[model samples]
Target: MAEQTQVHREQAGINAAAVRSAETAESTQQRLPRCRKLLFQFEVDMYAKIKTERLSFIRHNQTRLRADDYIYLHDAVADDRNANRLGNMVILPSSFTSCPRYMHERTQDAMTYVRHYCRPDLFITFTCNSKWDEISNELLPGQQSYDRHDVVARVFHLKLKQLMDYITTGAIFGAVRCHIYTIEWQKRGLPNAHILTWLWFHVPSTGSMWPAKQWFTLHERRFPIHARHPTVQHLSVHLENGQRVYFTEANLQQQLQEPRDTTLTAFFKLCTLDDFARTLLYCQLPAYYTFDASTKCWKRRVQGSSVPDHPGIYQTDALARVYTVHPNNRECFFLRIILHHVVGPVSFHHLRTVEGHVCATFHETCRRLGLLKDDAQWREALEEAATVRSPA
Candidate 1:
């Protein structure tokens, strides 16, 4: 019986080694080639498109910028309701780089129409991480395994488009009023999407007073936007090279147990949900309460440190840190749905006070319409176009 057991153990070890070897071989053979092939195809497509579109002297006599024209431009601006907003507004320009080229125009049109119909509070961007190689060897059915990068990119784009359409069209964020989006291809030949949304509700501003239903509370354990270390609990805030960085050091347990330790605990709870407090505390790291060895009590450092000056009157401590439903801080129960959950590589998300992205889109649109050569011509064209109803 002892001899049989020893033989079985040796056999199991051999099988494990064989499996590891096979996995290593597969990783080297499959992953590297797929990435390389995708990259190569992207480079070729980008070069081809640039040569055909950017440098093409083919005069598109069309006086107005079409939805399809904005599909590939780095910056695309639209006049009318789809125009980006100014002030403390939230704009989500989400891009999916996996949709088909032919579908871009129709998708853009449908999104604009829906945005006009629904009228939501703000826009949020959506991106999906690709898993083409995991799903199948060939990019498409009937193509050679190694030679399907183009088809794979196209199919992936289409899949993302379908997903976004279902979600934005009254699935997740409720009714959207007006929105605009763009689809662009990457250096790797994969398609990416940029979607803008405006909902029926107005996202509450930090300084202004609004109805109670416009805001909600956020807990630290539920939404952890703070920087915390477990092994070394003692935290100090200081500025270095114009950036907020965290440092940990060994300290006596007695000092940590004092009231000073509670500052971080309490501040983080407020910081996560308080946009106004967050802005004040952003780059300016305030000093925390520290135990003076002689005094034997907590004493806050007096380096001109002050409490956050919020604009509106807070009813309670909980109400002071109330936050509106923004994409980056969006949470459902104990789970963070957007920031912590969504998987995508190329994306941008933040709260904006100005429409900084609008100029680039406007200029690109003008250039494409051949109105960029002369300022007089461009101004005249825009003035003439303003008289007519804006494009759908």
Candidate 2:
């Protein structure tokens, strides 16, 4: 009996320690300020130049420019030689000066083949974040001498491809229809890829399909759903006038006032596993909220229509089964939030229409600036990268 009592005490101590650690982490995260949003200057001129140059190249080939061809074809980025912060000319590579028409033509062919075979839905972009300390530490490893651009480009390429492989084949989301990736160098000479991937599937569209019924196969085992049933997953819990309150699916809509197009409802409906792990994610930071007596939850300022049932579908995510409904195509609330958080404001223009033309324009800019390597070098790199790849 003494031994059992000691084991119980140890377990209780571990649980208490874990709770304290989680609270500390949450408090720290809440204290951290969100990075300010910024826009890249290329948004103004790079895309226009690509469209003009791409048209001339295509017209001469006697081939029609299908909406999808933009994914593979393009021109070099145009930079204002006089607009530098330090007033010094940006020294770019010699090859970066001209757009390679032949290379883009070949890429167009590859994209055509992919479009015919794969019916992709979600279009995604993957760019390397220079601010990531972990990558900098690994690539720069103490006392290593290397061309900053070359090393950074190589590492980002390999890492991005690794992530792409995982996403396409992973159970979370199946095979992508096709993916077009091109590397570009920023004014500061940092290399990043403008990648466009069309996944094979996506979340159900909004409107008539709005509020998609939670998909699940009923089993012999029982599952928790409501708050009073103490064993289900919850977003929050607190004491309300001395009565213990839990935020479960039953009260989520009433207590949280979640917008119609938000993912909260769908997520909670599908959150069936009582023992499933939970994570807390704050919406916006540098902003604080106080619990409302009427709503019984934290009140914070948010963008998007609060009217519920805002018309028009703007975005979709298959893995999460979430949709953002907005009347305007470019004003997708959820996607904007994602771009702000994941890609940073510098690359905000990369987010665009589902057809992915603007992204291709960025690739064209890379080619014009000679940021993209010539066919021979690119082919050699692909051969080397493929040598160790496991066959499908």
- After superposition, which runs of candidate 2 have C-alpha atoms over 4 Å from their true positions? 1-99, 110-120, 138-147, 203-392
* True-structure RMSD for candidate 2: 31.3
For every model shown, what is its TM-score relative to the native structure?
0.24, 0.24
> Best candidate, lDDT-wise?
1
Cα shift from native, residue 69, model 2 (Å): 30
lDDT of 1 by residue, 249-292 (tens): 22222222332322223334434554543433311222223334
TM-score result, candidate 2: 0.24
lDDT of 1: 0.33
| Model 2 Cα lDDT, one tens digit per residue, 1-392 | 36445545555565455334323134565221121111122222433444444443334322211111111111100232211121112222222323454343334333332323433344455566665443455332232212233235545555554555555544235545455555555676565555445655653333442123322221112111110100111122111111121232233233224322112322222222211111222222112222244544333324322323423211111111112223243223333233222211122243332234554333343333343456643453354334323121
